[model samples]
Target: MQGLQQFFTNISQFFEFLVVYYSIILGFCALISVLVLGIIMFLRKTVLADRVFAKAASWGLLILCLFCGKLKLIFETKAGWYTLGRWDLLCAHRIVSIIYIVGIFIFAAYFIYRRRRLHKFVKGLDKATTCSFDNEIRKYPGTISPFCIGCIHPIIVIPEKLDVQNALIVIKHEETHIKLGHLWIIAGYDMVRCLLWPNVFLHIAAKYIKRDLEDVCDAVTMQMNGIDPFDYGESLLANAKEIMLSRKNMKCEEGFLFAWDDNYKVLNKRIHRILERNGYDRKVVLAGGILFIMALIASIFGIKCFSYKRNNPLDISGIYSMTKMDTVVQDTEEKIVTGYDGDYIYIDGAALKEAYPDAEIEEQPLFVFVGGYYKIPGVGGGGGWGEFSASDVKDGVFRIENHDDIDVWNWMIMWL
Candidate 1:
């Protein structure tokens, strides 16, 4: 019990760090992502480029934003055009961390429960005695339209109400989704949706991704099977209009990649794109896309900088400035002693002497750098989301203005 309690304690503590770190950094990355997509969409229309390029860009940015927390390491302290304001109070209490952690677990648990329920339903399904395909094909009695589920031994569940002709079409579509690995993409996107459900920009991206995935599925399905685009579009319209679609499919959790949903808008747009497929050269679109993304990344990431001043405890009673931006206690492997217990960082005397050999360590005022929140009990701890680690023990404090802009770079030009 004690060991279990300690493990949970460690998890809670790490989550506390993550709550601040992820929210701030993700906020910045998401902002840039939305901007990047907007530009790419505009260009797509202007250049007569395929939706695939926009689709790829959306996927790239989605992944980049999720992993961009470590991107701060590569960037130097360069001032930009805008400053992020603080909502440090929202990131204030441990309860917030608990809520964040709980939300994730709830989604995860619910998914697990959903999948088990679905798997059980599939298992209890009468195993096909004489199926035409390698995958198990089962007819389910419900308004929920035909859909695919499972990962290892995949199952395609069709509604019993569908006539033989429409059933084949729907089956072919689901099969295309599986063969082209749309499920894998959907699986990944669903996880992201679960993790960042609170992020509105991500939801915007989600709508695009879902639309694109279907777009890709439709285009590829037609090409591979040589199906008439007109026929496919007509069939798709019929599927979208079917009253058999219901909320039951959502609970099925559309496990893996996707399930047939009653998203009328998605279906309508999909039909339009299908019938109007412009056979653009893939290589040209992809090559141009690469250049566009590189430029977009460079441009969108220009997080503007702003000047900020906060009380510094390390500023004994002398000229203090030029704090090394990288000497953060948590970030750096080097640590002397005496750290911040609250929202401020207390400078250690011995470390101070090491930085300024001439200074009388004992005579220096109690060094307390007040900028970010650090909750180290005995040792000093400090750093907002973008922790302002001050070593004014050397020069002006390199401040990344607002704590929310974790990747924003700052360097002090003068000292007080």
Candidate 2:
């Protein structure tokens, strides 16, 4: 148990060091997850998926919020046992929570405002070329999804004729986004992730997690539609032809959203697997659960081990007072030979002379000279080394221990 505890202690220390140096990257990873999930939710329209995503999101948000609140409190408060010590840990945590909550709210409000404006600016893009409901053929943009052209929420342009088909696949795909509330989450994620872009692991993790979310959504879509595997592939190819290669079709002005990018790569793989009759893998879910549990355990241990602790009175006095002294100037020194009976306070003769130049040295003992320095071990009546008697400081004279065996004071000096 001791060995394992030491090993874990080492690991926790290393992890804490990493956090201090790479906090921004960690933040980004969490933020990216939020964004991707939000995008998925908005595109799809289902409350159930949204609720699940929201719950996970809430936990992440809670953590970040707690951390932020702590930062603020730490900066605002004085550095001491009252602020940085274990007693203040909860207060610090509360501060972080406040910061995260405020930040998230501000970001959400801004995103909603922007989304609304965007919708008003461009709402006709999804309309098919024809207006008749019976024969409308809603065509997807070639290679890429629709792009926002105006400041308002940009409309997704689709041919009117394409609307004739139920568009179960597209609806499923988009519905996943809405139900998942991917947009809001992703927006929060991106904001945080951008601040920590240097961590490659975080970047990779963010990308992978987002892709996995998309895959999960795709699997659900296939399960719901029950379309022939071949037809789904055919639909993909058919829609691929309609997408324009122009930059205008890209989801982002500078980047492609639904092109043959990472998103599509995962999408393609998911579609193929679905067609092959591969159901959702329970192992993957199990593995994820196990990892989560391990992280939780590790986190709990780290908190317990690293969390602040109340300092004992004796230890606190010594530790806190050490900072106030500028120098240790010895006032006096006396050279005397003493029998090694484990009851003595051996003061350096030279150091004592240096501390007290005018002090007189009185000694009476079985003294012995060794290594050019006299040894005088002393044991007080009952008080310890730093302890003083009822008399004031001036009356208390420094005294060496009495040589005696079988005494408690004698045993204490032996250890010293």
Candidate 3:
């Protein structure tokens, strides 16, 4: 039982490390995405550039999750723990860890419920023969807009009241989504978003990815079918109207829909991109790519730069026979016995003095030496404090160098 307990404890610690690692990476990615988007807007908004930015954000997050373990080790070894101490970093880590674990279960339950609901909804629809794509077409009764459902085996779902021509247009649009495996991307983003629920920036980035995916699908569908951009826009508007008419009955969930009626800005952007003659510019693409690479490099270096090493105080809780080094300032030489008893260090033999009860020994890096302040007991048991330094512990011997007024035979202490 004890061994099993230790095993679980180690597992929990690893997961905590992962939570911290991912949070840092995702937060940095979010800031980068925002800055890139801002620059793109200043230059000019192209569907291609928007798509590239969205892809970068999504794929960057996925890459971070994959390399979380290696990154955690790098952070601990190079960055150090003290660098993160100013922000109550450990408390934030614990909070994020708890939320991450709980969010997984919540999202899992929600996904199962959504799947069951989709199955039940599909059963109530009448299967129709489709001439365009080889997907299963179903007529849905709800006010939800036409959307392609399922990742592996997708189904094109259309509202029952739509005309034959409009239905075909919606079918073509959804089929484009499946052809490009957009559903899989959506699934990946959803999982990452849930896991990093504390990161609002990642959430915004996910929204951008979903929007750009729809725009890309719209552009491809019109170009492939040789359909007039204006006519296609009209079809989207008709679907949006239907969705809005029954908006009160809609249960908003995490899934891909062809038309989101509530988002006028996104709808306008899609229509504008569809109607534009020239698509993505080559120069803009090159610029966006450069910006993305720069951001990635900056994020990596920023993490490394902000980390600092934390020193663990030495555990000097045992007795030792002490001797003071005869320095140029110290004339007397005598052998004294000293011991550290948890909270205080004691000097026994001639010229007895006790440490101020709160003396701390800080171990320097490379195990070179330990140093701290020690107060000597005065008349009526008062405190007279002074700084002290000791050489590295070698062969169970500690050499105290700067003992101030106290002098001993030799300045080396051996563990008793």
TM-score of 1: 0.56
lDDT of 1: 0.51
Models 1 onward score TM values of 0.56, 0.40, 0.54
Give the least accurate 10-residue stretch of model 1, judged by summed lDDT: 407-416
TM-score of 3: 0.54
lDDT (10s digit) by residue, model 1, range 1-416 = 99899778866654455565445444444444555557645664555356554554456555555544223322223322132222223445556545655666776787778778887876766543334475778866544556677666678877566776667667777787788666677677667656655555655655556566666677766766677888888776665545334434445433233345436665666677888876556577558777877865764354211212221222111223234322223212223223333333434445545654543432332222233322211111233322222333433222222222122121111121
Q: Could you tell me the lDDT of residue 209 within candidate 1? A: 63
Question: Which digits, one per residue and each the tens of the lDDT, describe model 2 over residues 1-416?
Answer: 99899778866644443333233223323434345445544443344333322324323422332222123233234652353333224323544434434554565666568656655544433454533322222344333442222222223334233433435455445455545455455555545544433323434455544554555555555555565666655655455444433344553442233343444555566557546755455576558657765775665555334322221111111101122232223112233221122444344434333443322332211122111110111101221222212121132234445333234322332232
Q: Which ten-residue region of model 3 has the weakest summed lDDT?
A: 374-383
Question: Per-residue alpha-carbon lDDT of model 3 for 136-197, expressed as tens digits?
Answer: 88876555688777887788777777888888888999998899778888877777666544
